[model samples]
Target chain A: MTVLEMRDVVKDYRLRNGLRSTRLRAVDEVSFTLEPGRTVALVGQSGSGKSTIAKLLMQLERPSSGEILVDGEPMPYRGARAAAYRKAVQMVFQDPFGSLNPYHTIGHHLARPVRLHHPAFSRRQVAERVLDLLRRVRLDPDFADRKPHELSGGQRQRVAIARALAPEPAILVADEPVSMLDVSIRLGVLNLLATLQREENLGVLYITHDLATARHFSDEIMVLYQGSVVEHGPADEVILNPQHEYTQLLADAAPAPERRLARHRQPTLAAREGGGQQPLG
Target chain B: METTTQGTTQGSAQSSPQGSTEAAAPSATAERRPVTRKRRLFPPMTLKLGVGLSIAGLIVLFGLIGPLVVGDPSTVRDIGLTGPGHGFLLGTTQTGQDIFAQLAYATRGSLIIGVVVGAITLLLSSFFGLVGAFVGGWVDEAFSLLTNIMLVIPGLPLVIVISSYVPNKSIWLVAAVLAITSWAGSARVLRGFTLSVRSRDYVLAARIGGEKRWRILLVEILPNLIPLLASQVVFAVIFAILGEAGLSFLGLGASGSFTWGTMLYFAQNGLSLRLGAWWWFAPPGLLIALFGAALSLINFSIDEIINPKLRSQTRAERNRWGMSREQRQAAAEVTV
Candidate 1:
């Protein structure tokens, strides 16, 4: 069991233009805790530093200040402890197309993480584990031999999810896992993720710009605006009664069927001019 | 269900129709698998590649097998400066040496130089280029500086200067000189490519997956660069052969060895041009040019693998007279 905690994390990028150099704060001081078996959705528009937070948690980028603690211990930078840290936490990238290596087969992608985490496993065991992971993601085992290009966007994202699950991670940081997928398949992938999260009891950090899925899929919602968290509460409360103006704006941005139906009750200019508006119940 | 359709403005109607269409997508892809597998098993062999390979193959076979069957090139005979006739297949040199035998041995020697230099260049360039760019910072800066310095230096002058200092230059010595002078350009190319690949999301994912730096560089990055590396190596081989020929023509080539360059050197010394002994010089010169052109054509084909735009350009050129729709589709299928 592991509890991942970000205690006031900040990330700054040094931007240089010719001779002048400026510091851009990509992620301001933000804090959150991810307990096992719970999903925390980091909701924000693009450039709101949601990905920076994910990167910082993945240890791809070091925090400018503050510390990320894993189960009360500060994150290790290198050596055995760091490797163990990697085994506990895994990520699914946004772009399924860009996240996978084109030259490698899907089996290679899954087998690598399994092999890394379980060095004692024989070659046969590793191969078996790879096939098992594919099945767990509801994919045909034949997909193990196929390269990433052979798979559709939804299928590739499923493979990415399986890869994150291969190491049997305690926490999964999914960075816009389904955004690049087609709209029709998004729910299927998300439901797959929610099912996996429940089965594995893995703490999840679901990062996205979509507020509805954030509310539906996550237990808690943390609205990030300009690298800072403006609102953080239970998912329903955040959606139902947004405390921050930014959170209200985000909630308003998502189309509400009720709101549309109410608008339809009062005839709109286009509806009046077109004179062909369908009646709504 | 409401959450899923948020990306699209179509609202509730979007999901069902798209969902039905997506169900067919999997079966469609299942049918495509065997075709892709077949394509992979037998990649479409382009005309340029076939022509180049055949020409190169014939030349290589001649070089390898010719020396074994031919008589001694050094054997002196009474009949000197003869043309292609009377059992002398290519003719006689100024000293009655068998020009055919000399050409055989010379082709073999030049090929050996090209292969050796090519191997050396591949090692040196990949080290300085791929390694440096993958491991950036001061190391990259230092390597880039060294590569830039090497790139700026004139190859022929440097080779000439190095060759002049050595009293008895062997074939290996000439090959080494050419390799050292020629690798910088390929190194720069590899470095630029490595820089771009290093930052790709897959590489980052590998790093986050706890992959060691060396493994990431080797397994993740190296395979993608294979086509580029092959193109560079072919270019290197061409350069080595041509550079060795130039050095030998200038009377600074490997001594006591038979190469196309040495054959040309001896022919030039004997005034084969003035004496109209075309057999003495023409075969070796023509062989050098043919070999270079064949390798270049092969290089262009390899370049198409690295930059797919070149493949499309060639296809467009092939269909310049205007192909029918079915013909174009067939062409596309073949290429695909």
Candidate 2:
């Protein structure tokens, strides 16, 4: 069953220059469906509108024109409906370092979302639940006492995950969850996320610029470019046999192990550096 | 790995890291020796507590304790006019009150006016500023217009005019008037800060997290503003103190109250300074300088704490004083 659906969504942001000089179509005519207990990755380049789609899905930015249905119900933009919608749909941001408040301890950060959503939980119960969440995310429960700055990058990301899960959200919108992590710990975080998704049966809309991780982490993939989806299919199919020219370009650009090894085996580093590199017009 | 995890869990069960939820969290640093010292220390609570404590301590000592220990500050004495004696520790005024007593009691009034005016100004400025910046469009334009009007008008002159018109205005009343007029600059600053914060992802998160606008402003954005707002408040208080003293020195403040400015005004009027009665004028002048210095020192300390670059430099300086190369490297690595 489709847990979340967006139909023909479009977002246009007005530039600071008073004339509405530059109209940035962040998300244009983008449509996708997220099924229950499935992970869908949105892959793209820096300005490929992948993050914009996540923002649209999370209602961080309202689409200029579109329909968003959550669990076969039309999501309202304000008041009671909006509150309910927000509770059901939570986000884990890309930059773990930038995501959590540096001022608050991990316990404080986790407790807030939980308490806000489920006000009925007694203080003691909430405390227990927070520990469970910390443990689930692979963070030592004791780390909750430490502030965001006290934790390593990977630990902080785990806290972010725990915070997102505090509400027991059915759909988790993880925007580049492991992008800013250390290369060594990046796989661990991804594995932890996949573990949580499977255990909780969460519908995850994972946004990233890395296709390699996307292939491992997601069940399906959507390649976004210039405010639109260029290609969409099963994750392996899209990664292995990219259909669109843009998808192929994205695949080629991704720094896969094979590419790195091949580059190392080249006759001369400088000569091989420029080879097979396509210019964007 | 299992044993390490179990050990971490066991250690966590002992005390639990600071405020962690479960008992399974490590107590301090036993979890496979995870890099636990990575946190920054410039949180809002520390900032608030530090500033609040300094303000409280200063007020209690100078304003409350000093006055209680010394005799009535308003009365003047001529005996110990520059000659130190057993009774007059800081000497005596031309009219013969204890200079020490007067200086101490005067702190109460000066600090009161400063705090009241500064707090009022901060509230007004932050409120209008956030409203203007966050709620943009017509509201911003209207507030900008108001700010511009306040900006262009000569503040000191306006205060002189306003104060002169009123009959025997008390310090608090005068402070209220000053607070009313002085909020424009702060409002402009806070508005700019809020405008920037409004674009941040956390602010966006708060909005989507079902937090009301007021909560977002107060809880999220306002907390971040402490480091900046704190210094702003100190500066405002200093200005307020100066303004109150200036008015009193000019004989425009509360006629009944005996503040440093009042003493100065009286001493000048009585021709005490010219007559070599340095006790009266010097006490108040020195008091003003002392208060200014204390506030400046505290502000400097706060600035060091807030700005990581400064904090790191300070750490480096301390390291230079004592730390070994290996110790410094370990500290650096631990932080990462």
lDDT of 1 by residue, A205-229 (tens): 9999999999999999999999999
Weakest 10 consecutive residues of candidate 2 chain A by summed lDDT: A272-281
Candidate 2 interface RMSD after superposing interface residues: 1.4
Off by over 4 Å in 1: A267-281, B1-43, B315-336
What are the Cα lDDT values of the candidates? 0.92, 0.79
Total backbone collisions for each predicted model: 0, 13
lDDT of model 2, residue B86 = 48
Which residue runs does candidate 2 get wrong by more than 4 Å? A18-20, A255-281, B1-60, B69-101, B131-141, B311-336
i-RMS for every candidate (Å) is: 0.7, 1.4
Candidate 2 residue-wise lDDT, B15-118, digit = tens: 65534544445554466344433323343344434665575576547787787788887665555466446467777765666777777877777778888998
Error of 1 at A182 (Å): 0.6
